[model samples]
Structures are given as structure tokens and as C-alpha cells.
Target: SIKLVLKMLDRQMAVIDKNIDGMLKEHFAEKLALFKDFKGVGPCMQAALMGALPELGQLTHAQIGKLVGVAPLNADSGRHKGKRITWGGRATVRTTLYMAALSAIRYNPVIKTFYERLLANGKLKKVALVACMHKMLTIMNAIVKSGIPWNPEHQNVSKNA
Candidate 1:
């Protein structure tokens, strides 16, 4: 059965669609097409990205991470463990990002290599997946904000990667 939350979101989108002015509608429709061209990115995920990062076209890497709740937070004390993962941001955004990460693992070489490396190190599946998602968000932020696309050969080399 369809969930009530999905039903509510559908109604909300209907109202918003009705209210968008003609020019903004046209503009978004056009840009949305461009977004759909990215591998594994669909309309729903693109919409989620735009909604989560409204200024996505303008955000820097760090700003984008915090917005999506993937940015690491300090969890250390005098003798505690490493940093803690953030857990209190937009849930829908994080879910969509998680899907993107899975797709990136299948189709994006750089991300795939990173994901394999995490797995090789014996990380739990979910933990490695979250790390992949964070990496995805960072790369997507740089691409969307800079009006560029993924270019493995041209990206700054990271030794840890």
C-alpha cells in the first residue's frame, strides 16, 4: 500500500506545481533535463538534490556536506574514539544521497575504486556505503555548483583514494 507520507508529499508537490510562475517553471524544466543526463540520476533524485541544496549552484564543498548531514562532527574527547558521523539533518536528502552512492559505485570508476578499497579494509557494508555516499555528495556538489561533470582524469589526485 502507498504510505501516507508519500501521499502527503504528492499533494504538496501538486500545490507547488500549480503555484510556480511560468518563467520559473520553464527554467526548471530545462535545467532538469540537463540534470537527467548524469548517469543514474533521475528526476526524483534530481528534485531531491535541488530541494536539499537550493543554492546547489552556488555552494562550496563544506557547505554542501553540512546541508546533507554527511559532514563529520567532532566526537573525540580526551580519550575517546574518532569523529562521529552526523545524524540530524534532512532525512530525505540523506536517503536520496544513499541511492546516488549505490549507483556511483556501479557506474563511476573513482567512486567504485574507493568503495572497493573500503570493502577491502573490512568495513561493514553500511559503513562503507555511507562513506561512499559522502564521497558522492562531495563530487556532485563540486560538479553542480561549478557547472561541470565528472572527469576522473582531471580531478585532483588524492593519495588515500
Candidate 2:
């Protein structure tokens, strides 16, 4: 009985996936196509981003990070310095981006290199992953803003600002 229920659930998820793909093709083809060029942004991630972050292209890199809850915030008070932490934004978007960053660290060259560099600098795994998520979001924002596909040679200018 459990197996049967699981199978039914899987079937339902498949159908939902199919419908999402069709909708993306029909209404958000350009955006979908652009996101598809990103190495680790699969259908689910693309859909989550498209639905949650409608201001993708228009916002600055920092704004996008804040919106997704990936931006590091200072926790200091007066002379007592505190660690930077991320807080308060769209939970679903952050969760989806976390998963995408996991995949990207494996498949995306830029993300992989950045992750490795962070680790080399003694950053914690989670810290590095969050940074990677921020970088990925910035890149996506830049791409959408510029109306260009993923260009390996293109540096994210907004990241430095």
C-alpha cells in the first residue's frame, strides 16, 4: 500500500512537471531559455526562480541577494563586532537556490571554482555554498538585465559594486 501511494505521488509530480514545462514554453520561453543556459538550473529551479523572482532583471545584484535571503547581514552592536548572517526573505526561493547551488558547485565551472577558492581561504562549507548562491543569483540577474545568455567570458560587474 505504501509503495502504491508513493508511485501515485510520483506520477502526480511528473504530471505537474510536464504542465510547468508547457507553461514556461508558452509564456516565459525567453526567460526559460536564458535560465536553461545556466549549467545547474534545472526545470524545477527555473520554475521556482521565475515564479518567485519576477524582478530578476531589474534589481541590482545586492537587491536580488537580499530578496532571496542570501545576502549577509551584520549582527554587530556598537563596538562588539558580530558574524555576518543571512536572514529574512523568501524561504522557498532560498531553499530552491540552496539546492541549485549544490548542483552548480558540481557542474558549473564558475561556481565550482568560487567554492573551491572559498574553501581554500578557510571558509566553512555552508558559508561557501551561500556565497556561491549569491554569486549565481548575481550572474542570473546580470544576464537577464543585459538580455544575454550565459557567457563564460563575461564577468559580473555588479558583483564588484
Best by TM-score: 2
> What is the alpha-carbon RMSD of candidate 1 to the true structure?
5.7
Clashes of each: 0, 0
lDDT of 2 by residue, 89-131 (tens): 8888889999999999998888999999999999999999999
Candidate topping lDDT = 2
lDDT of each: 0.72, 0.89
User: For candidate 1, lDDT tens digit of each residue in 21-42?
Assistant: 3434565664454444455565
TM-score of 1: 0.69
Q: Candidate 1 regions off by >4 Å?
A: 1-25, 29-37, 156-161
Please give the range of 10 consecutive residues that has the lowest summed lDDT in model 2.
Answer: 152-161
